[model samples]
Target: MRELRILVATAEAERLRGVLVMAAAQVALGGQATVFLQLDAVGLLRPPIEAPRDGAHQAAGLPSLAMVIDEALGSGVAILACQSGLALCGMSAEDLPAGVEVGGPIGFLQQTDDDARLLFA
Candidate 1:
């Protein structure tokens, strides 16, 4: 399967939403997709808030952040939060949502070792 990997470095709602939409689209097309959240992007891996919590910042016509994440995961997208990011944000692995992996250097290397297309979001 084709693999598409995205490196997320921001926590801005719109930016996060955009990248996730892209990743989820790839998954829907029968391709493998991954999102590696680093730095501020790790914020996306935090526990889900109530419905529409992030809907305000969502792009027009795109799914809510939570919905997009769920769809992507169901479609075999690997969502990862960087270990350094978690520490930097003072969050533990327990703070992350289910199905999200706490990744380190080695894990990052392995995930991108494939001929995956990389996008920085």
Candidate 2:
């Protein structure tokens, strides 16, 4: 079976959560998934209670954004936050959640090009 790798880049907080849900779905179906937090999306790397932005919806019994992120992490989803993204937000490496790599565009490019798919939200 072909591996499914996803590169999700979104600046909007709400949209970023939605993309994460989608990514989790892909993984549920036996696909490998990775998320690249770009621009404002990098703010989400903080712990859920300390998250910078909160636009996630909990209506219709859907899991909250934090829940989905937890699911992704538990499922072994790779999370990358752009190094420049942290700088742009006036944040440091310590501000991010544990295990989130601080890699930029060049690294993202190489990972996605190796038989992986790219999706932007």
Candidate 3:
């Protein structure tokens, strides 16, 4: 199975939720998946995650964004927060959730196989 490499560069809740869902789905299908969080997207991972549409999702019987993130992490989806993104957000590595990794784009790309599917959101 081809790997999925997703670049989550936005702070938008809906987009982030979609990216997480895709990554989680990829892993559930037995493919490797990585989500690289950069720019303002890094701020979304901080504890007590607040998404404006979280309530709507729950009301519609879908998992909230926070729940989706936790599900992605639990399902072997690799999540990397760019080091510079952390600095940009004034967040330290310790500020991220336990399963998230801290690294840069170059490192994230280097780990991707030639056959990996790359996505930007």
- Candidate 1 on 1-121: residue-level lDDT in tens? 6688888888776676678788878888888788888877786666753334465645556567777777777777788898998988889999987788888756776768647887887
Could you say which candidate leads in lDDT? Answer: 3
Tens digits of lDDT, candidate 2, 24-52:
77778888778888766786665543323
How well does model 3 score by local distance difference test? 0.90
Q: TM-score for all predictions?
A: 0.81, 0.79, 0.96
lDDT of 3 by residue, 71-95 (tens): 9999999999999999999999999
Report residue 66 deviation for candidate 1 (angstroms). 2.0
RMSD of each: 2.9, 2.9, 0.9
Q: Which scores greater on TM-score, model 1 or model 3?
A: 3
- Model 3 earns a TM-score of 0.96
Greater-lDDT candidate between 1 and 2: 1
What TM-score does candidate 2 get on C-alpha atoms?
Answer: 0.79
